[model samples]
Target: MTQAQSFSSTIFRRKPVVGARAPGQAADEPHLKRSIGTFQLTFFGVGATVGTGIFIVIPEAISMSGPAVILSFLIAGIAAGLAAICYAEMASAVPVSGSSYSYAYATMGEVVAVGIGACLMLEYGVSAAATSIGWGQYLNELINNLFGWSIPNELTAAPWGVDDPGWINLPSVILVVMCGLLLIRGASESALVNTIMVSIKIGVLLLFAAVCFTAFTSSHFSPFMPEGMAGVTSAAAVIFFTFIGLDAVSTAGDEVRNPQKAMPRAIVGALIVVVSIYLLTAVASIGAQAWTEFSPDDEASLSRLANSVTGSTWVGDIIALGAVISIFSVTLVVIYGQTRILFAMGRDGLLPKTFAQVSPKTMVPVNNTVIVCGVIALLGGFVPIDALWDLVSVGTLAAFITVSIGVVILRRTMPDLPRPFKVPGYPVTPVLSVAACVWILSGLAPVTFLFFGLWVAAALLFYFLWGRRHSKLNTGPASSADEVSQ
Candidate 1:
């Protein structure tokens, strides 16, 4: 092949989808064991999702859209639902651990897959760090409420995140390490813990809804669209990060039982549960308190709202406790997703081989998980949460758009491919998903776009320098699991 043709082939090369096992499998070949079922998989979605977003985003959204944040929730839900539908098709068809990165690889090309992997890193790894910061704050609040004393600011706050910077966020580092150890134990144990946390999360939110509704008066919702559709759209963009858990569910495709069936179900089920809870909580919050009272800086907004409704501090204490647990689960699942994405990149020869090596005893990516957690712990301990959070919504929306487009591309390019679950209303659905994400993207701050642009550029630069030459697709056709050998 000419140099031009070879270069073209390198960038556009795609991977073929095959069965789960590595080709020429030996009795001792390492692979991610399939232990997750539909039930645990659904909790993975809920646990990763129902975290600091609901506790924090409600107030943030209300500040942006007034009581019309209700409309914002609906708009964001529709957009997320459309994306989830497209994701379901991709996850079911690809059935891999890399989420949208694998889908883009199979449909778009290796270069696009690298870009998608960059986006996933932002969505999972950075968000894990951000969530850890939130968890530390909530843990402090819970402790103060229960014992009338809290961790010193030097131990709980980041070095540069606020007016009062501290030496380090020790709790944030602790949280990340705790989640990493759980992941190293194995996927099933992590899933069970996540399920329990999700249940508590749901219960706490329901409790908030039940109590808030009792004090609910129709007066607060009057002039619902006060700031109009512009406000709703902007708020939707702000809160869109909450919906990313639906996509997180797909990252476990390699470890899920009957992935063709469970993958789609888990994605759809998680979307429904997350959207419903968000809507219910949004409505209750607006009804219980005039939207004007919400402050953007309130870290314990939900708990504060509960306090006003009950005229006591006990309910707020419980809400803070729940927030602590919820953020832990979020940090855990986001770290899990990040490790798996790196594992996939490693398996494709895009990253170091150590990332792809599954531990023989635990059937998990122990080294990869440790590396991911270590990086996240450093970020959480030293970096400002504000600097880390804006990128998450931008990254997540970009990845969702990729998945929607990939569904269309795969359908056209690989018409004969087996798809256990096909996207409903194919052409229109994917098109709408793309449009919705783009509209939300437009509403993000200019700083966020700048950050995103720089991140993507860095990712492509790495690909050209190293990944393009070393990619497995360049070597030859190999099964997806071929690179996982010990």
Candidate 2:
């Protein structure tokens, strides 16, 4: 057979292409300012990780595990941290912006890359929608506390909301649109903004914990494991959504100044800070009231907790206001991450090229941002918040497990490649990362897995029908191939 025929036959083949520069990145292109240090990157991780789930997830988790939800938090954190360590190695090796999608493409086959991209869509896109929904609830709380007026139920709630079914969630849709506009305008979360957001998030949680602790009673701790080990694992699976953004630290690997030393520090630091805050807040909240009082249907549970603990509405108002501000930023960040991931896929020809188009005026993917926000707004405006959180957890867990496996695959395939940061326990760490994620996956409701499987299958179908024929690999030089096998 001719060389051209040989190359064409290998188009769908697996290739190990770590550290390859992404399409559109030019040799002469100006370098991104190497301004992010460990402290700043740590803040980015914390800022992205905290707000989305804590404001709304607490009640859901509590309902599952009672006072033992604290143990769930710890389990989720350890799993997240281990996956993050593996992610650091992948990021340092690949040094690109697509997060797990990019990592999988470099080490695994094109089909797997497309599958992981679908998982990321759920993680970032749906999480943004879920957080926006939570933000609307807090916005209503803040408005009512200050002005004695609330957004009408029809405008503030989704069709399937717990207390009141509404035609649409206008506030959540508005929040998503606002964030979309900012992204189109080239507004990004700089290091300073990240620090400020982190501070606001931590400050509000601390205030809630301190006030709730004042009303703590030992009797609330009885029968801590009310539902036993099953409940604890299930709660951990649900709460795992809170740690989804920890890998944002790895995605910025290329832009950091001294990634080898700084990446590990920032990831570990963010994990510790987030875990500590979650545990403290959980303990304070459960101590202040019986676990049975926690309700998954309550949209503004933290604010209500503050009010109940202090016997005043003003304290709850403070918590609500903080959630409004901080969750707005979280929505923006998650939306930004989603657009970039799609942008990466477009560049690789896994999707239409429209997604890769960069606006001359803004130098960002404007079309991609619009498409992402439109879908997110639809979900936020119509779907109930409770249903979206578990989907986010499932997608994130699958993506993290893929990253861990990618780490082990790259180690065996390219043993001599330069690595800026390595997983501490090497094979053991990656293995455990996979195990933890699998354990959490096992605890998710069967319905969640069914939905996830359908989504992944759809992505693979698109790949076979369209992506393989259009792939950049078919057109690039044979020498450009990263790896090839007969």
**Most TM-score-accurate candidate:** 1
Off by over 4 Å in 1: 21-30, 478-486
Query: lDDT score of model 2?
Result: 0.80
For model 1, residues 1-486, the per-residue Cα lDDT tens digits are: 999987776787777766643222233544698999999999899888887578866787898899888888888889999999999988777787888988888777788889989999988878888889888777887888889998998887787866678899998999998999999999999999999999999999999999999999899998888888888888998788877788789889889998888999999999899889988999999899999999776677888889899999899999998898898998889899998888888887888788889988999999999899999999999997778766888889989999999988877767666778898897999999999999988888898888888988999999999888787666665333222221
Model 2's C-alpha root-mean-square deviation from the true structure amounts to 3.2
Per-model TM-score on C-alpha atoms: 0.95, 0.92
Candidate no. 2 TM-score: 0.92
RMSD, every candidate, angstroms: 3.0, 3.2
Model 1 is weakest, by summed lDDT over 10 consecutive residues, at 477-486
Residue 410 deviation, candidate 2, in Å? 1.0
In order of listing, the candidates' clash counts read 0, 0
